[model samples]
Target: MLVRCSLLLPLLVWLAPAQGALERVDDFALLDQHGEFHQLSRYRHMRALAVMAYSADCPAMAEMAAGFEDLGHTLSDRDIAFLFIDTQGLDRGQLRGLELELPILDDGGRLVSAALEFGQAGEVALLFPERLSLFYQGAAGAGFEQTLDAVLAAEVTNSIADSIRAPLEAGCPLEFPVRETMLAEAPDYAGEVAPRIIENCGMCHRRGGVGPFALDSHLMLLGWSPMIREVLLNKRMPPMQVDPHIGHSRDAQYIAAEDLQVLVNWIDAGAPGPAGEADPLLALAEAPAPGWQLGEPDYIVQAPRQDIPPVGVLDYTYEETELGLGEEKWVRALQYLPGDQSVLHHLMSFVTGEGEDFWGAERRQENSTRRFLDGYAPGQDLLREFQPGTGVRIRPGEKLSMQFHYVTNGQSTSDATRIGLYFYDEPPEREIFTDAVSTRFLLPPNVPEFPLRASRRLERDAVLTGVRARMNFRGKKMKFAYQAPGEPLREIFSVPAYNYGWQPYYRLDEPIAIPAGATLHVIGAFDNSISNPNNPNPDAELRFGVESWEEMFTGYFTYHHAH
Candidate 1:
């Protein structure tokens, strides 16, 4: 026998006829399965927005799915944005298995479900976003068709649609059993919630850290609760996260489900701070400063001061500093020190030609053929040490060029970032080289998933020490594989869920060996449709380019050629 939680009693009691003026539905945002952010306000240009609360387990969904798809077809010509939101904690794997025509959005914590007051699975809510009012909230059968028709014709204006209450549909309750249980005993903030933040977010969210704001106090956290909640539930925080089932990395930051629930539940519970409780986060803020993890360096070089304006986009700041090396040098490890973490998007250094300074196509003719030394981005390991005998070589006269990508943080500031290098007493037996495995492809406008491929054949035996995928907002996923002499191709590293915000070098725990003649292949795709939230202009045909808004397909391989 099917059972339902009793929490639906109060929810049903509050349900009322949609005959009078309806309250404006608050603006909300959620990421679809395709990783595109869909905010209700962004779709105001549409005639109307149809949001359906969906679940796979409900038997009624089978009956309603075809109706929802049909409604989408009918309204597509009318400029109505149709979306299905998944309230259940469904992962990408489960979502992929479901037969869903409409893009399925993952609302991990049911935050949107609670906000919209979803009564049951397969409930359809029609909203007139321009007027900021709920047009109709009920079943999608006859009443939805009527409202959609009326809204499409001149019958129902934005104001008139608010007063039409569609009849309710019978369906299984969308149970949020945890909310009821949490109500009995609220999650303790200091004991349970704060510790999660400290463990998962403290590394970069503390004072002098890269995070835009500090999360070191109860008051501070409560103030930023809304933004924090959004990023966490959307899986944006603790960047460099991967699908654990696909691959594993020692540096990957995977937050436990229970820990995430504790924080989100605490925020949902109003973020109350008990009286007389000492703040652990505040105490952590006073702990001793974290010195260099690799100790004092052999040499340090700082870039020129980069003036950042109060607003507007700034082109990449390029500066060149001569290493003044008398002889060849071997750098075992190096670390970057960003002058201003808030605005520094990333810093890239290269061993460039004598006059080739910057790293964009617009800057120099030789920018595409330069040597990549190292780079630093948020959450990436800055102080990277090479294997026992392998190190990055520095030619005697090779100059270092720094390209700074600074994002505006709503404030004017300047930066003089520095790089610390530790050299070995003697050159290592093997030297590491960084090269890109990429191909050129055009992405048509409004295309959802366009496949692209790039490969390189090993000229000499080498160990693939690490790999980093490079793509702008439209990049979907990148996988690295190698086909050995007589063996089937095997996957080495895969960024199945690529995020433009965080691009970290995924170092292999055990480097894989590739003999000469083995081919290393890179596979990925691009999402250049309305579904890609990060795509700047889905209507614009995009080709490979250096600008952030443009698109590119490149996979960087870090390997040491065998002697």
Candidate 2:
């Protein structure tokens, strides 16, 4: 998408931009005109990414577009992706008219524009995604080709920095009104940036939380401003990487355009200390942790303790806990209290028969419906309460199957987790159910992206409440979409940059209604290559397995019957 870097860095030499030198550009993401998601860091498979600053108001827009199309064809064989960025805010309706084949990034707020220093339309930036180096910055025609040729020549010489070019002041100048205003007046630390941090990042970035550091003071903010900028630009923090252009979710961690503008602007403005003594961050950082968000549950089930080793990879462990329920109950919500969050990465729970495990019908069948309680990942809310009238029905003799996956954090620990079950006094009007859509394939070794799709047709009318994507180490990305009998395909959920460490069950803010004869689809791919950061071993020719070490593609749809 719109990955970038801006001027201003003293301590972090890696982020500094020297005159006539190759500058380091941070990563960012944005949706293109066709609703396709693109992120700079995700394109590690490519050698470089070329983006042109575009504005419809510019007079040379037509010729530049034509030349950019030619460059796209010229660089088609090369491992470079061509993209266009919109400095002026334009809706999809306005952009659809241009009908450009390239991904015209939606830079509505000018955040990425300001970060990348896109001062003029028709200006081009050639970026090396892996190294985050800027190879060239100049006008998008002859100079662009010359820089590309120089960069190619340097590849043979094994000297990338030698081919870098300085910025050329030729093109239609574009205006960034907010950046001008922000640059003029320093951002108020107490008023502007701290509140945004408290709201968006305070959850995990606190003292004892999972974050690497705590933002308890303004000084801490000032010290970690560069890293904060890095993570935000890369879409790494906020930890929830769902595309906002698609379906909305309450749990989706989204910062407003204005808020993002304020944050980066404040950071860029030397990150001055607080003008006033009042600091809101200290209170949130020192606050006591609350428990059982919905209050004490009707019944609490203790899971068997798992002993994690000091170091080494571990497969998925499955254990079933006997409920010993004398009577049946209508379950409303379940809360998972992880005993050891440091070692325990994530776990999945399911309501199963006496002898069944978490795999249930998934072992023999590629796709089947199952009873899914919850798929708990890091940074997710521990307490999950479903809609008022909808709850999974639990009967006597049913057991709770828990699957535990642990990641060693240089320490030995034992995790004896517990689950709090909230039950409805009476049977709910509607019953919540889950449909598991999965696929099995022998993934070839060292492949950058191996595409996979899994789909299942609905037997009747159903209202989809939530969706969860499941894959092992090599998982790259996954999207959930559906199509009715006569309607066009609609995307409901998307994990644009999937992280195996953060597989939180995404609950949609608004549920989608699907009629009978509709087909739900799960589209995704695996990156079994060195480009993938989380890939344990790209050379492993793996098949589907229940263990986290092996690979499995499964998309769970949580829905309720309409009738």
**Backbone Cα, N, C clashes tallied per candidate:** 0, 3
lDDT for each residue of candidate 2 in 145-174, tens digit (9 for 90 to 100)? 766765454452123232234454666888
lDDT of 1: 0.72
Q: Which regions of candidate 2 fall more than 4 Å away from where they truly are?
A: 1-21, 91-94, 153-158, 161-163, 166-170, 306-317, 340-345, 377-379, 405-415
Candidate 2: 10-residue stretch with minimal lDDT: 8-17
lDDT of 1 at 165: 45
How much does candidate 1 score in TM-score?
0.76
Look at candidate 1 and tell me the lDDT of residue 506: 73
**Model 2: pairs clashing at backbone N, Cα or C within 3 Å:** 1-38, 1-39, 3-28
In model 1, pairs of residues that clash are none
Index of the highest-lDDT prediction: 2
